[model samples]
Target chain A: MTSVLEIRNLHVSVADKPILKGVNLLVKQGEVHALMGPNGTGKSTLAYTLMGHPLYVVTGGQVIFKGVDLLELAPDERSRLGLFLAFQYPVAIPGVSVANFLRTALNARRRAANPADKGIPIPEFRKLLKAKMDMLQVSHDFAGRYLNDGFSGGEKKRAEILQMATLDPEIAVLDETDSGLDIDALRIVAEGVNKLAGPNMGALVITHYQRILNYIKPNVVHIMLGGQIVESGEADLALHLEERGYDWVREKYQEKAEA
Target chain B: MSEQVAELEKLSEYKYGFSDNVHYAYQSQRGLNAGVVRTLSGMKGEPQWMLDFRLKALDIFNKKPMPTWGGKISLDLDEITYYTRPSEKTESSWDDVPADIKNTFDKLGIPEAERKFLAGVGAQYESEMVYHSVQKHLEELGVIFLSSDDGLRQYPELFREHFGKVVPPTDNKFAACNSAVWSGGSFVYVPKGVHVEMPLQAYFRLNAEGTGQFERTLIIVDEGAQVHYVEGCTAPTYSRDSFHSGVIEIIVKKGARCRYTTIQNWSTNVYNLVTQRAVVHEGATMEWVDANLGSQLTMKYPSCYLVGEGAHGEILSMAFAGPGQHQDTGGKVVHGAPNTTSKITSKSISRAGGRTSYRGLLKVYKGATGSKSSVVCDALLIDDKSRSDTYPVIEIDENEVTIGHEASVSKVGEEQLFYLMSRGIPKDQAEGLVVAGFIEPLVKELPMEYAVELNRLVQLQMEGSVG
Candidate 1:
């Protein structure tokens, strides 16, 4: 079976800053991969470069998502290839209701991938949104509000999960979804993500703390140091890092990178 | 002035021939002067007071010259005919109206529109109204709906009292011209504590080229009375130039509410220069909904005066300028009383080398404490050849007042279009939807039919649009 996400020797930069020097990672189908790193270790930068943000430039390497060249596509084009990005700081678009925006996005993706089948009608789309809201334990009034306007940290993260469940993208790059949430809210978000994640959907969970991993146990743990992952292990590394901290990995990887 | 001039006038006749088709028994000669005012008054057989009003306005008109602020004003009053009436007698019965005049209105769906929803209907053909009527129930409530000519006849004292009160003859040059040559328009008066539930509409159809239409409308809503007046105009496409300079004056008495809507879609040859003003008394409200779609050059700014305590004003206007057009439109509000409020939102779209401008004003008087006003001007330039401008002025004399003004001019971003097209909406549909979304806040304030028609017109104007 093909891997859902494959990033080989990925080198990316931002404004002459070397964020991701050389990173290699692969998550197979039906798996959750958690990349744990300290500040300025290129964890979130990898997510943006993978999702094809306009500002991030991929200097070298290839990103193959389900046997397709993800680097050659635009942000929206990458989205059409069933790739989703849950930003740490979601942008707000005032006067655009959440319901209307999501419907437009979903219809656009559908029309790009399949031409004969058009967008969902208004009533049917409303029904789908209502059911998704109920499943996510979100209030119906949330649909009427502008997209992420004045939303709380927890609400914004949960809204991301709600969008995830709606679009059902093949690969979701969760960029620090647990960064701003409290422990309980983080658990709730992890539970929502776990429920939405399945055999067909692969998730790349990017985070700094190890608490979210307690709720969401990843199939593999990748340790990022100095803009690249220097160590790969099973979920035990998450527990080890939680007990020993990132200095151990950082010092060890610094020596190995120099060698 | 010369024999060749007379022969040349005879040779280059009207491109649009509605003047000759809709015949009248009594009419004034071409051009304007003090003698023409007396001639037009004599033709109408108006009383002495009406004749005096016209003579005073003629003096003011002769003293004032054309405005110099705007760009490329092509008004030639010397070559323009000041008065041309379509009928001698105003008909109470619709059947009594002439066949050609009725057919002209029939094409515009006036009869069906009146039957479906209208509190009153007044149709003006050329310089005189050929048809005017009000519902019986409204008449029973002492609601007066009549043409300005009949208003001058029947309500002479009331007409003289409020005539040119809101906008004086010295307000501007074209205003004085309109006051002097103004013939037929709608007159509305609602008694205290009564509300007119339906829309009172006045349709001005100009069918004659080289003929100038100067219609003056006055509306008075008594205390606690509410009314909505809708006015629409259209002129047949003509090669030769036509003139339309209307003056609308509205008075919302203490605690009364009134909304005046004007939709002007004249042909490209018509110079649409109108002056609309309204005064709101204590605890009253006034609203102006203006939509300008077609004209060679339109310089119109509806003004509102908040005179009494707690008066409110809202001006929602939109302008669309296509090829060879200049839509110079906006609004103004003056808060005179305490706790008054006002809002002005102007949206413009220009393409095909056309120009759209927002020139607005907001003023708060010295004693008007706790006053608030906001002015937002947004212009969308669809191509490089088009132009858009905004000039907003805000004056606050009181300590406790809030004023905000915002202006933005931007082209349609390619990234937005690409995003929409990626979603499967065709390029044109995507562009249309984005444009509609840009103006959604204003369109939602309009009536349903008008909103839909405006959207359709926006899309049609952008047809075959290319960078």
Candidate 2:
């Protein structure tokens, strides 16, 4: 099957300091891929580069999403192309309610899919929003609050999942959604991701812990070190890495680099 | 940045720059003197006391040199026409107003707003109020809403008692100028125990060039009464600069509450200098929601004198300065009675080489024990060339008082922009949302229509900032 997202020899830097060096990855439809790595291994850098963050310079690479080259697009264009990133730390946008933000995102995606689309009606938008919130057990009051303003860590994570659910992106890159979440929140977020996983969508869950995968049940797992993938295995790879830590992976990558 | 500069060049095109083709019944010669003041008062056929008051104010205005402390406003007094009255009489009904004058208010959606939400409406064209009306039910409830001139003619006792009490002619240069030639403003009096649920609105429009608009507004909320008054001002863009110096005085009697909201969107050629003040009586509350979005230069500070024990005052100010515009505005509160409190929140945004400043004063008197005051001023600069400044003075003569102040100046955060854009919002829209959020505290306090207009103006200011 053709992959939903293909990243080849991805190289990215920030302020002249190279962070993502020659990374390669692929995500197929309906498949959940887990990216595990230690701290400072540039996991979040890869996610940001994939989302076309301006600060993360794409020195050399090609990111193909649904036969379209993502590097040539703006961040909003990338998002309109069904690429979504569940940020580990979502920025607080005061005065913009969550419902309004979701409606805008949904409208942008609809307009992108068909230029003639006039966007969704308000009543229908509210209904869809309520349905999504109910699916994740989010409170109705969350829709009225400012976008992530004064939200707790778990609330921010839940809001991110809520956005993924509402936008219904083709491929989602969730960067460390598990960090800072309590057990109940982790389960709920993982369940949200699992419920959204189907033939029409793919997910790349970047995390440092094996705990989230226990609930997510990733189809494939990859360990990253030194800005490159060091090993690929089944979901068990996450458990092994969590138990043994990343020293072995670092050693293997060092030896490979020397060779 | 080059694209932004190109966009800034297009900013000179004003949206409301259409001149109305009409002849004025009375247009003062373009200068100021005792004769001009006499001419204005004599035209209105004022009583002897009012004419004397006008002459006294004119002398004060002549003696008081232009203020040197605020934004640099290069208004040539000789070039400005002191008065321009389009209509000979203030009409109580829209049908009696001239068609040309009515068309301007129609274009501004004033009648529609009045129908939907306002209990009364006052539409000022040039120098005089061409139309003024209050709902019959509100009138029957003893609510008095009329033109300042009509208020003096009809309710002379009430008008004379509160006209210059809050903001006297000697307060400042602009106040003296406004007192000398004031016309076309709203005078609302809500009687005791009566609450006007809907807002009383006043719309001021300047159509003629080289003219100065001086409107005096007086509002008295009687004991146990409540009211909300909203005023909006705009002028057609002109090559020769115009001047606007108005005075607004309000009195919140004991156990009353009053909210005054002003949305000023004048053309860039106008210098807007105004003084607004209110006195909060025992257990009364007064709120000032002031938004300044346009003008070549603006220097306004709405103040409240908490004269009665346990009174409360609040000021929520929002200022937006675009290219070639300077907005210097803030709030002042004087706590003169025991247990009084006041709060001031100011938010400002500047872009495309514009400047914004927050200059506020908070004074707690010696006899006022247990008084509290807090002031917060936050400014956002969209580009490096834009500027913002904060000057807050808090003087405490009493030892038993709590005072707090916080000020911050910030640029639009790159991370926040990315966070919004990652969710499919365009760069310009994202920036607009950030700005709207920055002033959300103040905008939320405005009426619904004003809030919507404020957001649209913010979006217009944020246009072309993204490359």
State every prediction's TM-score relative to the real structure: 0.76, 0.90
Best by DockQ: 2
Clashing pairs in 1: A108-B423
Fnat for every candidate: 0.08, 0.80
Model 1 agreement with the true structure over B1-467: per-residue lDDT tens digits: 34433422442343222222223354455567887888888888988877887788889888897887665776557666676553432212333222433343344444443321111112333333332234565688888877777777888888778888998778998888888888877778899999998777564222111123688888999999999887763312222226778899999999999998877666565688899999999999999989887778898999999999999999998888888899999999999999999999998888789899998988899999999998988898878999998888788889999888888887876655544433334556556656666676777666677676666656655764311
- Give one digit per residue, the lDDT tens place, for model 2 in A11-77: 8889998877889999987989999888788899999998988889989989898899999999998
| Candidate DockQ scores, in order | 0.13, 0.78
Where does candidate 2 chain A have its weakest 10-residue lDDT segment?
A250-259
Candidate 1's displacement at residue B442, Å, is 3.0
Clashes (candidate 2):
0
Clashes of each: 1, 0
Interface RMSD of 1: 4.5
